[model samples]
Target: MAVLVVGGSGFLGRELVGQSLAAGHQVAATCLTQPPDLVGPAWHALDVRDRRQVADLVTAIEPDVVINAAYRKADWSSTADGAAHVALAAASAGARLVHVSSDAVFSGAAVRYDETSVPDPIAPYGAAKAAAETAVTAICPDAVIARTSLIIGDGGSVHEQRVRALATGRMSGVLFTDEVRCPVHVADLAAALLELASSDHAGIHHVAGADAVSRHELGTLIARRDGLDAAALPSGRRAGTDLPGPLDVRLDCTATRQRLRTELRGARQFLGH
Candidate 1:
């Protein structure tokens, strides 16, 4: 199958492009700036915000599947317009669209959220992602929406910075033990997405690690794994309960396991524990 991956320069996007190409599929990817080391697929400089450009690219690639992995940088705004534009373009080309979303769409109140769970995003980022999900599904009912959580990999964005801070003993004390999340590996997530794209399944799906870990626990795990300090530095406003609303977002991947017939790597296992 031929596939088009948007935002192929990002952490997860890089892995998806590599994996798809390795799986004997024709892959075409797009990125804003120069992408990381990519060899197998055709890389095109694409700005998803430009609807015409996105549509033209997809139409030219004529891919059997289109994966919308691009996202706007987290800022004060709370909407994912670029990602939605990719979905719109994919739908215009009549290609199967796969929209990557976040577990943050939920309010994080539920102990376990399934595909059927309604989105109640508290943060602007989550709200924007939720809006993007709605747009993709409403436009193309056949499009697959995969809601995942914290993605773990080497030298990405969030995880890498945290590790660096710990190594330098510059890690602040503002840690949130209240925030619980399931972190999935980039490779595993790409595999599951490929399976879903190859199949005829539609609607929303939750793909995540097998277990949930609190923010403090996650930080400590990464610190210990990398042989760094795991002690509290100093408590700040961000350290207390008044910190950004912590969500206990643990996704239930029953449908994903049963339908795709694949096993997801647990957070501890993925983190090299």
Candidate 2:
């Protein structure tokens, strides 16, 4: 299938592009700044927020699938500008739309959220993403919305920095042991997304790591894996408050697994543990 990846230059987008290319699919990616060297796809200088440009590009490519992974903020957003444009463009081009969403849309109060959870976003970014989810589904009924959680990998993430700080004895604060999260590695997430692109699973789907761990535990594990001092880092509960969102952010991936025909694994395996 010919696929167009909007915001194909970001961290997750890079992984998606690489995975799609490796799967022997025709890919076209767009970037705002530096477009990376995509092996199996042509890179285009496209901006998703600009309606005319997005429309022109989509119409020209006439892609069978359009994966919208572009977002202004990784965590929060108050405006739905980027999301709206992508949805509108996808509808205009008559392509199957796949919108990347987040588990942040949920308040994280539920122990495990399915695709049916009503979004109660506490942050601006979460609110905007939720809005995008509604708009995309309404505009394009065939659109696929994948809501994922904290992304983990070796390629520069918030968790990686924290691990580095403690390993190098540069830690200044305690890790949050109370804040639990299910972090999916970018590579695994990409693989699942590719599987979804070829399936008929339309509507919202939650994607996250199989195992959920507290912030402190995750940090400790990373330290242990790298042969660093796990005891050197402080507990993440210095503030004595659960994270603003759900304490246990595990997702029910039954639908995702059924469609992909494979179970998604947790983030710990990325360290080869």
Candidate 3:
């Protein structure tokens, strides 16, 4: 099958491109800036915030499936408006869509969320993601809205890098013991997303890890895996801080898990003790 992966330069996006190539699929990928060094995908310079550009690119490629993994945490135009543009283009091209979402849409008041939970975002990023989800759902009825969490790789994820930086005193920040999330491996997430894209399943699907761990605990795990000093990785609490976000948001992926052939391993399982 021919596939289009948006945000090909990103950590998760890179994995998606690689996996698609390995599956022997004809792949086209888009990047906001320069394309990556990966040789398999046909690369395009796309600004998803630009509706005409998005539509034109999708029109030119005419891919069978479009998997949107593009997002900017601080920019609403990139996160929300971009999603709508991509959705519109995919729908117009009659292509299947799998739009990636985040567990940040939850406010943590419920603590644990499922596919049925309504988004009640507290921060701008979360709100933007929620908006993206809404647009994708309404625009593409057959699209899969896969809401994942804290995508960790072998060592390439931002969070994992942050942990390494903190342990070596290259960065200065405390991993909040109270802030928790179900972190999914990048490979697993990318594979599951591809699996979902190829399937007929539609609507909201929670595709996070099985284990819900605090940021500090997650950092310690990273440190352990990387042979860093776990004690040097400072821990703190986000509860009393001025941070405007959830303290604990764990997605319940039981229903989604039953439908997928990919195994979404937990951080502990993937990273080890």
Candidate 4:
């Protein structure tokens, strides 16, 4: 299978590219700002927000699968609009699309969410993700929307780095005791996504960790894993914050487990006891 991974320079995108190459698939990856550190896959400088560029690239590659992992932190045009462009381009080229979405699409009103849950995004980022999902599905009905949670692992994940910084007194912030999420390991998510590239599974699929934990617990676990003092990490609640975000966006991965052979490990298992 020839796979084209958008945003291949990102944390998750990098892993997907590497795993795809290892699986003996012909891989081509795109980068916007940062260049991918790993070798083996063909790399291209691409900005998914550019519709013509996206269409031209997809037409030229004509890959069997196109994985849309491109995202900009809070940029709607790049994150949401870019996803639409990629999906449309892939669909036009008759390529299978696997769009990576987030649990943030939910407003955290529900304790647990599944693939059937409706999107109720609260933040701008979450809204962008929700928009992306909608556009991808509308443009390409056959596209697979893999909605995952906080990605954490050994590859210097941002979540772990923040916890380490707080534990070491380099950063002063409280880990939320109220905000709960199912944080999946990067390697596990990457493997599942790569496998899904060839799958005919359409619609939204929750591909997340098995365990749902509070932010404080996740931070403490990451601190302990990095040999930092877990007690040093402060905890707080997001309920009374000025700009409060989602409280609990836990995704149930029962569908993912039944569909894919890849095992999505929980953060506790990845970080150890």
Give the number of the best model, judged by TM-score.
3
Whole-model lDDT values for every prediction: 0.79, 0.78, 0.96, 0.91
- lDDT by residue for model 3 over 1-273, one digit each (tens)? 999999988999999999999999999999999998989999999999999999999999999999999988999999999999999999999999999999999999999999999999999999999999999999999999999999999898999889999999999989999999999999999999999999999999999998999999999999999999999998988988888878999999999999999999999999995
Candidate 3, position 266, lDDT: 95
Q: What is the lDDT of candidate 2?
A: 0.78
The C-alpha stretches of model 3 lying farther than 4 A from their native spots are none
Evaluate model 3: give its lDDT. Answer: 0.96
Query: Which ranges of candidate 1 are over 4 A from the true structure?
Result: 75-79, 154-157, 171-173, 232-245
Tens-digit lDDT string for candidate 4 (120-204): 9989999999999999999999989999999998938898889988999999989999889999999999998887877778889
Cα-based TM-score, every candidate: 0.90, 0.89, 0.99, 0.98
How well does candidate 4 score on lDDT at residue 145? 96
Pairs of colliding residues, candidate 2: 76-125, 77-125, 108-246, 175-236, 176-236
Model 1: colliding residue pairs:
78-124, 79-128
lDDT of 1 at 102: 89
lDDT of 1 by residue, 159-221 (tens): 656755855667644545667888887888989998899899999999998878876667666
Question: 2 or 3: which has the higher lDDT?
Answer: 3
Task: Name the runs in model 2 displaced over 4 angstroms.
Answer: 37-40, 74-79, 238-247
Which whole-number lDDT from 0 to 100 does residue 21 have in model 2?
Answer: 84
- Report each candidate's C-alpha RMSD, comma-separated, in the order given: 2.4, 2.5, 0.6, 1.0
